[model samples]
Target: MAVNYPNGKKFLAESHMPKTTKKKDLIYSNRGMTLEEEINSSNEHYLSSGRAVIHKKPTPIQVVKVDYPKRSAAVIREAYYRQSSTTDYNGVYKGHYLDFEAKETKNKTSIPLSNFHEHQILHMKRCILQHGITFVLIRFSFFNRVFLLNSSYLIDFWEDTMNNGRKSIPLAFIEEKGIDVAYGFNPRLDYLDAVDKLLEHTNK
Candidate 1:
């Protein structure tokens, strides 16, 4: 389904940019796997191990033009996002619904709220209201820090912004409220550990 911002801005699912390209130069290099790629690999590990069933949602695209040079070969010349995506990833984990968005920022001190759109936040709010486990996996590539922040805190900051507050969340605030996820060899990003903590809190 197509989601839109309050101002009528349609969400574009296929929009994302990697924080860094060169690995050898940066101290916290992702080793060529962008945040999205690492998460995909982690999800694969989870699925294969029967740990979870999370999957990244495919961005729906509307093909504008196509060329057929040969009968067996077809090329997409032009296309655009068909609908605004709800979130980056979602699925079932231990019989509970899991929903989240993954983001990376080069800034070391703070993560801009602009990284999230209105509709995305709304979708998260809805998911939480419906008793789904929702959160955002944010990567601070420069500092080599990855955090799993709950959607409730995200919503609070979002509402604060709408009320004319800060436009970004400071790293200190995130560190205090978010769970630090360590990078690993097998699953890549070990965010599910953070999820366990989140569930623990929720159950309490």
Candidate 2:
């Protein structure tokens, strides 16, 4: 059984691939969880503690073919994405519509704006227009720092790039504009604390 993209390219799962290592790419840290894994842990804690209701958005896939090798098992032979996904996650928080994207960068100086897409920035803008709380959780993997940046800043930088402005968001600018999220035990990344501060200022 095989899965494919809409463009007729065969899709391979990362878990099924052979692992390779690069000495330059290695980071010395006791906390080895990826940004997405940490967020998932936080979401679970939030859900169980009645703090928030957020979940990762599943990509829509359309299965074109399947094979029943056994009476109890069916394997998908072909599939394609139904459409481009909007964001990484979305749900309700503190009686407000929450929509956000989580990204991790190993760069020590700046996070490249290319980490974001035009459609995603537009989607965040649309969410804001609906009076929803939309933002990005940026993890600077090199420094082990996390920042919760509001969507407006992300949208502005994206537009600036269209005019041949800076290609990356400076760490200094992020430290100034975005709220820092401290790492913790139970939830791992305490991003909701940053969101609470944002709500305190904007109340939107």
Each candidate's lDDT (Cα)?
Answer: 0.85, 0.83
Q: Give all candidate RMSDs, comma-separated.
A: 9.5, 7.2
RMSD of candidate 2 to true structure, Å:
7.2
lDDT of 1 by residue, 1-204 (tens): 463323322332333323232232155545656888788878888999999999999898999998665433355789998756599899998899999999999998999999999999989989988999999999999987899999899999999999999999999999999999989877888899999999998899
Off by over 4 Å in 2: 1-30, 81-83
Q: How far does residue 86 in candidate 1 sit from its true spot (Å)? A: 0.4
Query: What TM value does model 2 have?
Result: 0.82
Q: What is the Å distance of residue 131 in model 1 from its true position? A: 0.7
Clashes of each: 0, 0
Question: Global CA lDDT of candidate 2, please?
Answer: 0.83
Off-target runs (Cα >4 Å) in candidate 1 are: 1-30, 67-70
- Model 1 weakest lDDT span, ten residues long: 4-13
Candidate 2 lDDT tens digits, 1-204: 474323322554655443322111134333467788778778988999999999988888999998655433456889998754588899999798999999999899889999998889888988888999999999999889999999899888889999999899989999999999998877778899999999998955
Error of 1 at 46 (Å): 0.8
